[model samples]
Target chain A: MSVKLTDDVGAALVAAIVARSPYRRALTPMIGEITRIALANNQIRAALADVAIRSNFEATRTLGRRDLGPQRATLMSFLEYVYFASPAFLASVGEGPKEGSHNGH
Target chain B: MAIEADHCDVAIVGTGAGGGIIAHRLAKAGLKVVSLEQGGRLPDDYFSETAPPGAKLDFGIGPSTVWPADPHDSLFVHPLFADGAHGATPRPADGFRHFQILKLNGLQNLWNGVSVRFCEADFAGWPFGYDHLADDYSQVERLITVCGTKEGIAELPDGEFIPPKPLRPADTMIVNAVKSLREPFSHAIPNRKAIITTPGLANSCISTGICTSGCPVGAVYKFSARLLPEIAGLDNYELRTNAKVTRVLREPGAETVSGVEYIDTKTGERRRLEARFVVLAAGAIETPRILFNSADDADPAGLANRTDRVGQGLQDNPKSVLSTSLLKLWGHKRTYDIGYGDLLILMSRGKLPDGSDFPFIGHAIHGLPDVPHYLSGFAGFPPAVKIRMARMMFHSYVTLGLFCAGEARPENRIRPGSTTDSDGVPQVTIDFTTPPAAREQMASMLKWGRKILRKASATKIYESIDNNGTGIHYAGTTAISDDPSAGVVDRDLRCHGLDNLYVCDGGVIPNLPDKHLTLSIMALSNRLGRHLEERVQSETKVAA
Candidate 1:
C-alpha cells in the first residue's frame, strides 16, 4: 500500500508523535517545518503507509504508537532528530535547570 | 600544465592537527611555511547553528555529506582490508568510513575534543619517552584549553587543565562505582577535553551534545577555528587550499627531498612547490600512501623505505561500548549539560597472556544528543513508548566507552592499491586484522565495564564490541626508532635515509596507546616545529 506524504498526512503524523512527548507545547510550532523535512525522507514516507490503512484520526494516532517493528524504531529516530533540531526544544533544554536543582543527591 | 610554485622553508602536506600546529610554530618563528590542503576551506558559518538546512543539517547529526560519500571523490582515499589469500575486500565496518576527512582543517574539524596524553609506559618502543614530550604536551593543552582535574595517576598522566563541567547525576553514579572497584581499577577522573570552558568566551560550549557532527559553537578545539586564525596573519605563512599532494620529490642522486608534486584540485593542474624541508602530516593512512606512491629508481621501495618500513606496523585502538541505565536516576529530568561527550575517565590495569600489566581506559558518556537514537534501537518498543522512554530515562543512561591497546604488528599494514585515484595518487589499502590479544583484552574490559555498571545498580545493560580500526586512532605506519634498519623515521622524525623529509603525524607513533592519539600527535608536531626552527637557525649560521 502506497501512501502519499501530503501536508495533511505529514501534519497528522508529526502531531501524533509530538503529542506523546512531554515538551509537546514547546515543540508544537516546529511541527510544520519538521513535517515538511521528515516527509521528504523515504524511510518516513514508507512508514506512513501503515498509517494510511486506518480510517479515523484516532486510529492513525494509535497505530503510530503501536509496534511496527523496525519502522517504529525509524519513526522514533526521526522524532528524536526533530526534537534535537527544533529551536524551541533546544531553547527549553539548552540552559538546563537552575544551579540548585537536582545535582544527583 | 606543470607550474612552479614559490619555494619556502617548509612545505607541509595536510592542515590537520600536525600540519596546522607545525605551520603556526614555524611561521611564528619567521620561517616561510606553505601548507597544502587537498580540501577547500569551509565557510565561516559552516558550523553555525542557525545555518540553512541541507548540507549543514547533513553535517550535524545526519549521514555526513561532509565526508566524501564516494571513493572516487578527490577527498576520498579507498581503504581495503586483506581477504584470506592475497585478495582484498572493502572493510565492512562503518566506523572506518569517517577515517578520511580531507578538508582545510582535515580530521580535527570532526574530532570529539577528547584530549589525552600518552603516559610513561605508552612510550615503550619510541626513541624518546613521555618526559621528553611533557613540555610539548603542556604547550598543546594550554593552546587548546583542555578541561579536567589533575588525578595524579601514573598511567593516565595529568595535564594542565581548566575547570571541567560539573558531573551530572549519572556521571557521579558511574564514577562512584569505578571508585568502589579493587586495586588497579579505582582510578577515575573527569574526562579531559580540548574545549573552551571559560565563561563569556565568544562561542563557549553550551552542552549541545552534538559534538562529533561538528560543534556549532567554536567551543570544541578545531584547527580551523583555533589555530588557522592565529597563523593567518603571519607574513611567512601561506595556505593553499584545493592542493592535493601526490608525492615528495627527491633530487636524483641526493638523499634530501627537493620539493613536492601536487595536483591543484581546483584547476586540475599539476604543480611543484620546492622547499628546504618536506613534512607529511596527511594522516596515518594517506601519509603512508603518499610515501609508497613516491617509489622511484633512486629509492626503489619508496623515499623513506630504505628499511622497507614505510607502510608497516599499522595499529588502531580496539574499542567496546557498554550501555547502562542507572536505576536510581530513572524518570529524572534530562539535563542538557553534556559539555562535549564523556564526563569521566575510568582507568584500570589488566594482565596480558604473558602476565604483563596492560593499561585500559573507559570514558563515561551521558546526555549525548543521540541518546534518543540509541533508545529507539531497543526491541519490542513502539515509537511512542520509545520517545517517552527517551525523555524519561535520558538522565539515567550512561555508556562506558572502553578502549584497549593495539599491538604494532608488521603484517598489519597500509599499502598503495593497484589502482590510482582521481588525482593519480594510488588508493590506500589498509590490511589489518585485530590481534587475538586485543580481542581478549576487549572481552576483559567489557567484563570489568559490566561489573562497574552492576555496582552502580544499572537496571539494564547492553554490550557492543567494534572491530579493529573502529577506534579511528590510526598510527605506526612510518614508525620512529633510533636504529635506521628497523624504522622509517629517526628520533627527530626525519625520514631514515632522506635528510630533509619528515613525518609529524600519527604515522610516527610506534604503538597504539589506550588513550586517544590527537594530543600526542600535536605534541610531536610541536616538538618537530621547535627542532626545525633550531635546525634552520643553526644551518643559516653555519652558512654565514
Candidate 2:
C-alpha cells in the first residue's frame, strides 16, 4: 500500500514508511489478520487497504522515498493496481505465462 | 576548478526512444538542448559489425554477456541461471502460477518486434486515455518510422506505419488454421520497427536475421547511430557522450530544479551542469536507482520521495514461448536466413461478464523459417521412428515451433533493490510470479498456437520447456501517477513534488501489457519534448 501522496493521512504514512517507523512492523501482523477478516466479510477494499498499509510499511523501510524520489508518481501508479485494482485486473484478462523460463535480471 | 560554461536550457538523459525524441523536438523548437549519452558516440561504421547475441553485448553498456561473467548488471547473478554463460532455461518461481515467465534479464530477449497500442479499456480508469496521446503517438511514429497496418480496432491505435514483413510458408500454414477456426484472431505485424532499406550507405545490410546482434548496415533506427546525430545537427542541440549525471540539484523546498552533477567517464572528472530543467531517460532500472541515489539527509526519503512510492509497484509484461517440433517432410532440410522468417502480429481482447474488458492483449509470430527446420529434429521420437516420421512428411508433415508473448496485469510487479553481489553494486532483485489469469490466457494461446500448427498436419509439436530471461525490456515501476500513492510521476513525467525534474523512460509506463514499450517510451519523450518547448516558449515570451 502506497502512502497516498495527496493527503495528510498519506503524507504521514509516507513519512512513516520512508522512515521505517517501528509502528510499521506492528501493523504487518495486524494487517494480515485484518485482511483475512475483511476477506471473510467480502470487504475486498478493506482487505486491500490493510495489505497496502503493510506494503507501505515495508516499502518505506527498504526502498524509502529516496530510491523512488524522482519516480514517486510512477511508483504510486503501479501501487494503485497492486493494492486496489489487482483483483479486477485478473478477472477480465486470463493471466498469461512468463515470457522467458529462467533468466534473471 | 575551471569555471567552464556547461549550461543549457534543458538536459536530457539517454538517447533511445525517450532522449532521441526529446532532442529532436527541443532542438527543432530552437531551445538550447544538451543531451547526455552514457554510450560511445559511434557512427554508422561501428554498427556494421555482426556478432552473436552474447558477443555483441559491448554495443550497449554491459560487456560481452559470456556465461558466468554476466557483464550486464541487468540480470541477477545466481547459480543455475544464465550467469551470462549458458543456454536459457525455465525458472518459474511458482509451479501453480497461471502465466509463463520468460527468463530474459531484460526486455530485449523477449521482444519479437510486435508493436502495439494501449486500448481505451486498458487505460479505462487511469488519469488519461489513448485518444489524449494520439497526436503524440503520431509524432513518435513519424520520428521512428513505424511499420504495420491499422486493424480497425476501437481499442488499438493505427498510424502511418511501414508495410509489415511477409509471412513465411510455415507461418502462412498456421495462419490458415487460425483463420479456419474463426476465433476472431488477427495476425500481428511488426508494428514500429527501425529497419529501412536505404540506398546511399556504403555498407548495405540485406536485412539478415541478426537484429539482436545489432543491425550491420545503417538501416535500423537505433538511437546512437540514427537519431542522435540527426538531432545534434539541429544547431540548438549539443550532445555530451560518456557523461554520467549523478544528481538533480534542487533548491530547498519547492520542486524547482537548478542543475545537475555528473562525472565525465573519459576524464573521471566531476562537473556541474547548469540547466533550467532536467529530464531523466536512463532506461527503467537506472532511473529509479538514480532517484534513490540522489536522496540526501535533508530529503532522506530521496528528492521527490515524500510519498515513499518510488520503487514499489514495478511490473513486467507477462510473456510465454511455446516451442514445438514438426515432423520432417521427405525432401526438406531446415535452414532459414535472417530475413526469411514469417512474422505476424496478433491483436484481440476477451470481455468479462460485466462488459468491462480484460488486459490480456496481443502477440506477434516471427521466425517461422527456422521453426519448421528446427522442429523436424526434435520430434521426440526414436531413431527407429525416423522412417515413420519420413513417411508422415510425404503427406506434407513438417516440424512446427511457436512462441507466445502475452500481457501481464498490473499485479505482477518488480521493485529496485539489491542483493549481496560479488561486486558491491546492488544486484537487481526482481520478485515476479505469474498471475493465474495471465497463465490461463497463455495456456489458451498455446492451445490455439498448437491448433493452428496442427492444421498444417505438423507431425511433431514440442512446447519448449527450457528458456531463460527475456533480455532488456523491464518497465512499469516508476509510472505516471494521478494519485501520489499510486504512482511515482505525474502525467507530464514530472515528479509530484519536484517542479523541474522529470523521468522519461520505460519505468514511467503505467502498464506493460506487451513488451513493445520502446515505442511508447519514444512517444512519451516526444510528448515531453513538446511540453518542454511550450514551457521554454512561454518563458521567452514573458522575458520579451
Candidate 3:
C-alpha cells in the first residue's frame, strides 16, 4: 500500500531515521528515494511540518542557546550540518537527485 | 563527470590567495580554467575553528585556561613548502632560525588575516610603478572586506577600506598616547585586516578572539570562503584537489608551454593535463621548486630556469614580539579582551631614533590567558602577586613585531634535495641567512620598540625567544624584473622566454617588504589575470 506522506511526516521520518541510526551516510539516500517516491506520486504533498524541528534549525543557526550551555553549541552545529543540506532535505522529501537516487555522501 | 577536456584555457598551480584570485578572474571571463591544488578539500567540520584540537576551553579550574595548541604538522591546507626535505642549515640565532613550509591549507588555513599594502619607497627598485598595483590593491581590498583607515603616510600607502574596527580600551590609550607625543614616534592606525566585523548573518564575526585558531564563522577572509564558492560553481572552472603538478610540458624547440604533468596524491596515478597557459601560484618556495623539478632532458635546469635563476634569491621578513601594558591609559574604566585578533592589529612603520626606517611591524592586541608567560615577565613580584600582576597587566596588552625586509641574495636559495615525499616529488631545501643589515635593524627595531613602550606606557615586557611566527611571508625565489638576468620572470610575471608560462605568488616578489604578503600577492595575481585576458583576446583577434 502506498502511504500518503505530508512534510510533517516526512521530516519526522527523516529526524527519526537520522537520530535512531547513527549512519546517515548509509541510509539518507534510501530515505531520499522513499521521500522522492512518496512526493512524486502526490502521496506526500501535505503543507504541515514538525513545527518544533523546523524552528530548531532556524533558532540554532542564529545560535539562540536558550541557556543549554556548550551542548547547545554542539546542537547548533548538528542543525547547521543539516541546514547546508536543506536541498537534500527537499530532495529526500521531494525528488531524488537527477544524477543519482541517493543524495547522502 | 570528471573534467574531460584535453586542454583548458588556463591551468593554475596551487589555490592560495594568488591562485584563487587569478582563477576567479580568468574563469569569470568565460575561459575554461583548471586549478591544480596539492591538497584535498578539508571536510566541513574541519572549518570549525572551535572544535577540539582546533580550539580549547578552560575556566582555570581544571584545564586552567590553556592556549590553543599550535597547528603542529597541520601544514597549510594548501602550501608552497617542499615536502620530505631536511633543514640543511642550522639557525642558532633567536631571530633567524628555520625556513619552514606549511602544506594542506596553504598559508590561508593558519593565516591571521593581516593585510597591508606597500607604499612609495617600498617599491623603489621595481620595474613597474605603484600606479600599476594601486587599483588592483583597492579592488582586492574591497573583495576581501579589509577594515582599516587609509592614511596620508607616503611609505605606508592606504587604499579603499571598510570602516575601521572600533578600538579596544588599550588601543584607545595607545592611540591617544601616540597622538600626544611631540614628534609622534609612531601612528596607531587601525589594522588592515581581512576580517568581516559586520557581514550578512551567515558569515559575521562574533569577535571570539581566537582567530588564529582559524575563523570558524567564515568572518576571517580565507581564500576558500572568499574566492572558492564563486569560482567552484562556475561552469568554466574546475578545481582538481589531490593533484600535484609535477612539471610543465613544452615540446622540443617550442616557444610556449603546451601543458602540464601532475600526480594524483591519493591514488598514486600519473596524469597529464593540457592548457594554453600555465600559471604557477604554488607559493614562494614551491613555485621555484616546481620550476626546478620541471627540468626536461633537453632543459635539465627546469622549465623556466633557462636563466639559471629559477630558484634563486629566497627571502623572508624577520619578526620579533614585545608585550606591553596600556595600564597608564587604563584608569578606572572596565575593559574586556574579547576583540577578534585579525580585526584589531595596529601597524607602525619601524623607525629608529636616527630617522632611518626598517620594515613595518603590525601588532595585535589579544585577550590571551597565559599566566606562565606573564609570570616570567613580571618576575620581580612574589608568586601570588605575580599572578595578580600578570592578570592585571595582561588585561591591557599589545604584542608587536617588525617587518625587516631581508635581501634576496642568490646565496639564499632553494635547490632540489635528495629526499622525496611519498609522491616521489623530490624535496627542496632553502638556504637563507638573516642579512647583517637586517639583523642590525631587528636589534635596533626591538630596542626602539622597548624604548617606545616604556615611554608610551608599558610595565613588564616579553619577547619571542625564537623565530616562531616569522618568514611565512616568504618570497622572491622567482623575482620579477625588466632584466632577465636578475629575475626568473618579467614585469608582467611571464617567464622570460616562454609566452604562456607564468609565475604569480610570493615567487614573483623580487624584494621582501614589511607588509602582509597576501594583499600584494592578490593584487599582483589580479593584475596578471587581467593582463593575460587582454593578451589572449588580442591573440585571438590576430588569429581570427
Best by lDDT: 1
Worst 10 residues of 2 chain B by lDDT: B96-105
Q: For residues B1-544, could you state the per-residue lDDT of candidate 1 as single tens digits?
A: 1132479889999998899889888888989898998888777766554332112342133322111121112112211112212122133353243266667777777677889989898999888898999999999999888999988777778899999888777777787887777565457788889888776777677665445556666788877788878878777788888888888897665888888898887789989999999999998888887887788888777778877888798888877788777888776665445555577888887666677767788788775333133433454675467556655665577778788887888888887666555555566677777788888788778888898899888877778776555577888888999888888889999988788999999889988888899999999999999999999999999999
Fraction of true interface contacts that also occur in model 3 = 0.00
Which lDDT tens digits does candidate 3 get at residues B143-189? 88887786786667887777755666666655655566544436667
Best by TM-score: 1
| lDDT against the true structure, each candidate | 0.72, 0.50, 0.63
> What are the per-residue Cα lDDT tens digits for candidate 2 across A1-105?
323322333333443332332223333333433233222222232323343454554354333335444334332322221221122221222211122110111
Error of 2 at B207 (Å): 2.7
Stretches of candidate 2 exceeding 4 Å from the true structure = A1-105, B1-5, B41-47, B50-113, B185-192, B197-205, B325-342, B348-429, B464-471
Question: Against the true two-chain complex, what DockQ does each candidate achieve?
Answer: 0.09, 0.01, 0.01
Top-down TM-score ranking: 1, 3, 2
Q: Rank the candidates by DockQ, best first.
A: 1, 3, 2
User: Could you tell me which 10 consecutive residues in candidate 1 chain B have the lowest summed lDDT?
Assistant: B66-75
Clashing pairs in 1: none
Runs of candidate 1 with Cα error greater than 4 angstroms are A1-105, B1-5, B50-98, B334-336, B351-357, B368-371, B382-388
TM per prediction: 0.83, 0.66, 0.75
Clashes of 1: 0
Cα RMSDs of all predictions?
6.7, 19.7, 15.2
